[model samples]
Target: MFYTYILASQRNGTLYTGSTDDLAKRVFEHKEKARAGFTAKYGVDKLVWFEAFEERENAFRRERRIKEWRRAWKLRLIEETNTDWRDLYDDLNNLLSY
Candidate 1:
């Protein structure tokens, strides 16, 4: 499965949109600052929202669309799903079977 995800620094702070095949792993990498890029530079590691796609093309398309959206729109989207703007990494980590 592929995924389109959004990472945010804070409730109305910086936003990043990207597509990846491994949602959990990608998000983990971002949090760990494993990759050097915009995410690491801006400290945008909180997984605000994400959508899974059956195809990579669809995931990419969705990611591009989200990237083009205004900051207000993106924040609204995140707020709709994650009202508290909490770090979703723990939730994803719990999904693992140890």
Candidate 2:
């Protein structure tokens, strides 16, 4: 599956939108600060929102659109699904285990 995901530093903090085919690995890399970049610099490694797609192109397009949105809109999108802004990577792992 392909995915459109949002990572956040903290509640109301820095946010990033990205697309990947391997959601778990990508999020794990972010959490590990695998490379020097925006996510590493700002500690934006919390998986707060995500959507799965069958096609990578679809995920990429959604990610791009999300990135272009206003901060308030993005915050609202996260709050709509993740009111607590919790790290969803753990939950994803659990889901995969089932």
Candidate 3:
């Protein structure tokens, strides 16, 4: 599966959107600050929202579209699924472990 995901520094804080085939590993990299980039610099490491696609192209396309969305739109998207802005990384890892 491919994934489009959003990470935030905290509730109503900095946000980032990305797509990857390995969602868990990619989010882990961000959380650990594995690379010095926007996410690392801005401390956006919490997985607030994500969507999976059966095709890589679809995931990438979704990510690009989300990247163009206004901040309010993105925030609304997150809040729709995650009203408390909880970190979803742990749940993702747990699911993958099974």
Per-residue lDDT of candidate 3, residues 1-98 (tens digit): 89999999999999999999999999999989999999999999999999888899999999999999999999999999999999999899775554
**Per-prediction TM-score:** 0.90, 0.94, 0.94
Best by lDDT: 3
Residue pairs clashing in model 2 are: none
Query: Which candidate order results from sorting by lDDT in descending order?
Result: 3, 2, 1
Off by over 4 Å in 1: 93-98
Per-residue CA lDDT of candidate 2, range 6-98, in tens?
999999999999999999999999999998999999999999999888899999999999989999999999999999999999899775543
Error of 3 at 57 (Å): 0.5
> Among all windows of ten consecutive residues in candidate 1, which has the lowest summed lDDT?
89-98
lDDT of prediction 2: 0.94
User: Per-residue lDDT of 1-98 in model 1, one digit per residue for the tens?
Assistant: 88898998887888899999988999999999999999999999999888877899999999999889988888888889899998777787564333
Model 3 local distance difference test score = 0.95
Number of clashes recorded per candidate: 0, 0, 0
Model 3: how far residue 43 lies from native, Å: 0.5
